[model samples]
Target: MAPKVLIVLSSHDHFPANGKPTGWYLPEFAHPYHVLKDKAELVIASPKGGEAPLDPNSVEMFKNDPVSADFLQNSQELWKNTVKLADVLPKVNEFDAVFYVGGHGPMYDLHYDPTSLALIQSFSEAKKPVSAVCHGPTVFLRATSASGQPLLTNASAVTGFSNVEEDQAGLTSLMPYMLEDELVRVTGGQYVKADQPWGEKVVVSKTSNGAVLITGQNPASATGVGQEILKALGVN
Candidate 1:
């Protein structure tokens, strides 16, 4: 049987800082989706269970990318009809891994969402890989291990939407908090980033508790993150 992977998306569609519209980044989700589509059985899900919005600007910016454009056109229904994450929590063991796809939206919701925290915890407890790209790693800011340490604690290495990248985007103030900073402050794990902003960077770490934590630094790294997840799951 193919490994089952649950892809979690943020249901929050607007930024709290400016009330500006934001959702999952198109490329962040699309790139990974394409990478794993055939290699694994994928499931789309969100906290609110329906119509997980796409960051409009990301849609516009990545419109030229063939994979992003293709997913935007053909896979709308997957995101439009996400399963309720809470509902899926009970059956978490049925999957081999969980992936979080990011945009500005997740910084506000998934970080503190009880359902999301519990779901991530479930995956870790099951000794499954938990992966995310870009702002998706923000979800780990609050997710804890069986021993109640930050999930990233003692992770071999970690990466996320970096402080430099956030500043370059001019969204540093719009974010709830600097992801790279908080990731380090809370976990004490090595938070590394690409040598250049917006460059591809993926880090796959085995946490002290034995859960695999995979993270990518930006949209450019999303596909690599997916590939790493497949490798970790022992999927072809």
Candidate 2:
């Protein structure tokens, strides 16, 4: 049997009434799903579970992308199969990897979620790959190693929605905190970026033990992020 990997998504759907858009981008979720579904047994989970919200902009674009449109057509079935975040009592030793999909929602929900933190730490402790992207890294802000050091601190390379991208999206003023800056500050890990907005792909940082932590800049990098995860899993 192929190794199983858990894919955690944010439960948040709507942005504040301020009219700013948020939630997981269609490509971010769909691209990874397409890649990993064939190679690993994937278990999707969310903080609140049951029908996670899809971003409106993402939905609009999904209609235009054949791959995404197909996924949406099967969304109901997908939701039915998803394991509730609370129900996923993940034993790091049992899974080969854990992937946290990002959106503005993660900044609001996953950042302080104890279960989410435990999942990441458990994966790290078990020497399994732990992957996240965009604002998904927010969860790491509070995750620490067994030694109490910040999990990503000086251990892995990381990236997220850059300050430049946040500013462009006009969310810099509304969000509770900046993700890119905080990741670098808290972990002292080197943060890199692509040259253009929404064009950055995945960057994988490997530990001496060969465990990999990979991150993508935004939705555009989702496919690449998924591919990196496959590579780390030793899949061709």
Candidate 3:
């Protein structure tokens, strides 16, 4: 059988407070999907199980890129075919890895969904590679192991969308909370970002039992982050 990868996308279609349209970033999924589809069987799953939403801005920004163009061309086909997070939990063993594709929408939905948290813990407990990029790391906010400790408590290294980047984007005032602060202060995670905000940063950390975790900093880091995930999974 081909090695299988579970790609989790946010089901949300808007940002929380402002009610602004937002969803999964196209490049975050497209870049990695293009690389991994040939190497593994890619399964797109979402909280709601059917169609996942795409952030409007990302669609405009990446419309010209070849990979993103393909995603746009096939958006209807992709959205029509996602599986539920619940369905994936029972068959977690069938997957070689689980990857969380990121966007502002993830902060609104996956960040607080108990099922999403359970799914991440399931992959971790199974010793499978778990990969996330940008705000996709938001899914980890509520995940914990069977031992009762927070999943990221004092982890060697991790990176995600940063506070300064939020400020740089001039949307810090709009989000529910600062992601960088939550990772460090609330989750007991050691948050790391590039010297400058939004730079390509990836952190590959392993648990004592050999479970692998790979994280990327932001949208620009999406392609490199996906390559790192492929590497961690032993894909050529």
In terms of lDDT, the best-performing candidate is 1
TM-score of each: 0.98, 0.90, 0.94
lDDT for model 3 = 0.83
Residue lDDT tens for model 2, 6-121: 88888776666476666766777887888898899888888887776667777785688877787888755564455677677545566889888887888888899888887777
**How do the residues 2-91 of candidate 1 rate in per-residue lDDT, one tens digit apiece?**
999999999998887788899999999998999899999999999999899889999999989999999999989999999999899999
Q: Give stretches of model 3 more than 4 Å off.
A: 186-189, 207-210
Clashing pairs in 1: none
Point to the candidate with the largest TM-score.
1
For model 2, the superposed segments whose C-alpha errors exceed 4 Å read: 16-21, 207-210
lDDT of each candidate versus the true structure:
0.90, 0.78, 0.83
- Sum up the clashes in candidate 3: 0
